[model samples]
Target: MIETYVDERDYKLLERDRYTFFVLKRIMGGECKLLLSDHERLILCFTGHPFPVWIWTADDAAEEEMEKAYQLAKENKLLTGEYHFNIKYSLAEYFIRRAAEEGLELKIITNMFAYDCLEPVRPDTESDGGIHCCEMKDLEELVDFMDRFHKELSIDQKDISGYREDAEEFIRSGNMYLWKDEQGHNVASCKYAPDGDMASINLVFTRPEFRRRHYAENLVYQVTMKAKEAGYVPMLYTDADYVASNACYEKIGYVLRGKLCTIG
Candidate 1:
């Protein structure tokens, strides 16, 4: 059932509620609404405003018209877009291309749109390493942790940082787990997505001093367990060729459901 709600805050209110696969449209913290699977108005309420080219969602197969609409909307200073594409028509590349041609900033997220990705209830006991899981529950500590991680990885740029709101949001609404070293510092960290029934692992980072120690395996196993306990399936999306992460996902029992290619 597709419904649309007018208030942005109201739309995201379900972030902690419902479990349906859905999409949300929040225009600069003003109007918000929920969208059902087939372009239904799950709950759409307009803040009584549509002066902007409010693109709640679009169909990729209707590319030509969609692009034209996007161009018109953009030129008129009314272009905000939300897209939902599965493996069948995964528009990661399409969105990247359109964003460039239309001068829009786009973020692409890929998930288990092709397969029912599952992880072992726990790690293989026969495996040499063990598991470690710790939740940051604290935002300050998370930022500090990221700072140290960036330094350890030699990731320069003073302005280069992860999303502050995302970290805080995850700490409150999601689960944050880390693989620990003997000294108890995190060797790797994976913050699950805020969604209830699905897990999207992000910020998977390993320190230079701790690379290739099966830290990913430990961290992934720990995070997956948390998801299981929460009654949600644990999953992740990463650079397809991130050898360590890809191997870790396989080691923990995730199948290659499909491939995601992004232009930007």
Candidate 2:
């Protein structure tokens, strides 16, 4: 059976499932809404505006239950428009095939790897004095870094004005940090997206001139350490095909946990 749940308390039932913890944490943080099948076996979380509907199903979830979950989303208009869907690889093929049969097109598919780290992180000894939280005065430089970061990845570029606004909010929330060299030139940056006891390290980037210097790695290590120190389990998602980044996360002590696919 499928049902919709609105109460924040419903998230407590998901605490034991680490694979779904980030989505559950987002729901608990009021960042999204939740729908469940059989109380938790099949979970669908919707974060409106640019974010996708994250679907997580138990390994033993029957095919019928998965189909029902998709049907519920369609009936509620959740699958319409330009919204995207993110699900495990084990279910992505089935979900995509089924959606096509229903005349819903999911054109772009990207494979990703999820990583999690539980042990305390050790910061690079040489990076200690160069890393620090971003301040309001650094907004313009941060925006420049973000633009270059997006361009390098071929991701759509955000309007500079809008980007500045978001960066300001991120700085005010104490979620952004940057790495600077001895001359005070910013070389790399990263940020945290926290939900409950789980926080995802995101926006990791380094200037092309600083690519091989381990600046990006150091920034991620610092952010991960901060998240762990604050009592949150640190995790991150990266493109599976991005070898350098995948290797960097592994070197930073994150272990591969699962694979996810995004369709839009």
Candidate 3:
């Protein structure tokens, strides 16, 4: 995939904040192609290894532009397209619906808490799961849980492993939380990327069997707790399309600063 991934330095330069926010990661497998249609920039990032396909736009483009890119990918056998934007800061759903009509799957990520954004969250009537600080010893469980998570999310196993390796290294660089169940099986987790005065939360994932179980809530609870205790503002970036994740972040208390249109 990497071999075919079209190198787009200008796109990265424009959407760097998305990478800074964890809303977008560079395509590491297969190849990427960038399409320029009149005024809008369309990026087609596809890995033939059954990985999730991603479509990004700098902003709202002419409908024909997106359609053209969509048609090209459809011709090339790519089916997934993700649109990221924040509810509080993004353009409404008209474009997202259009993407759907074209058969592109959309996923959005947002801040965990958005409504009354405050530190020290209020607990919800959550599941019976606990969050633990994970060490390298838990690598096997982490990989297993991630495998199931990808399956549930319809992501390719190969893509998850490529990411899991980097995730382990990133988690090791900070305080990592591993949410586990009564039997001590890890269910959810988050990694805090510490920078100067802020620690951006990245890679918040829960196992498929644990979805809607509030494992993500509780795990985020611990993640925010530790971040607050360390005296840094905890923050996260969402692609802004996955409304469910955005809702989860809002329920958790993450405030939306703005929307980012990742051109990856």
Candidate 4:
């Protein structure tokens, strides 16, 4: 049987899977609800507001128990609408197969990678541009970048005001940075947000005209360095199909740590 509340044993299980459950560590005891199988071998952490579902299954967890836990979660309406399964790469096949058995299509979205200054990162490309924290004066340009970013990714585009608001928020957070050429033109941008002991570096983009100048690599390197200097482990998610981006991150010292699959 699956239980809704987690006990001491479950906490220990969570600790054993800390890397796979990093996001859970940052949100537990708040908006998240824990669901555990009797042996605490299979678990789910579902957050209400954000509506993300995370699943974990121990190597020894019985197949029957895993199915039971998933069914119970569905009965509780936890799997309604769209639910992406954020789980370890080792468990991806099991979930994907199970989703197929249930007539639900699931797919691997991206691989998660982490980095520490310990790895010998490739030397930053020599570029004439310098990194600078974004300010309100850069809002208009930031909005344009945001638009191109979503379009390039094929993600649903947000309205102009939504992009403007995102730009303003990034600027106010003081974590967004732009790579400005010697002539003071913004060539690339990158930003990070701290979550518990991890800082997720995202929104790394360079304008089309500046693609080959190594501006993006330089900007990401600078932003990642800032994240590390602030005492947070640096990490990011990248689409597995995006070979160039993955190659870029690897050159900067990031190592593939895990993967997430989306279930619908």
Q: TM-score of each candidate?
A: 0.56, 0.82, 0.54, 0.75
Name the top TM-score candidate: 2
- Model 2: runs farther than 4 Å from truth? 1-4, 31-38, 78-81, 102-108, 120-129, 150-158
RMSD each, Å: 7.9, 3.2, 7.2, 3.8
Model 1 misplaced regions, further than 4 Å: 1-60, 69-73, 76-116, 121-141, 147-169, 194-196, 258-261
Tens digits of per-residue lDDT, candidate 3, 1-264, equal 112333456345334334332322334222444322222254445444543344554555565655565565556644444323322213224335655776754444333231223565556756685778877888767666666655654534555667579558755875877888888878887877655456677567887676788888778867887887888777776545678877777777787765543221
What is candidate 4's lDDT per residue for 1-264, written digit by digit as tens?
Answer: 656666667667766655556656555555556544454577677765334567777766666756665675667675554555666655666666776787866677655443333352644676886999999999999999889988886543678998999799999999999999999999898998787677878888898998888888878888888888888888776776678877888898888766554443
Residue 160 CA displacement from its true place in model 2, Å: 3.6
**Model 2: residue 94 alpha-carbon error in angstroms:** 1.3
Clashes of each: 20, 0, 23, 0
Better of 1 and 4 by TM-score: 4
**What TM-score does prediction 1 earn?**
0.56
Model 3 is weakest, by summed lDDT over 10 consecutive residues, at 83-92
Q: What lDDT would candidate 1 get against the real structure?
A: 0.48
Task: Arrange candidates by TM-score, descending.
Answer: 2, 4, 1, 3
Better of 2 and 3 by lDDT: 2
RMSD of 1: 7.9
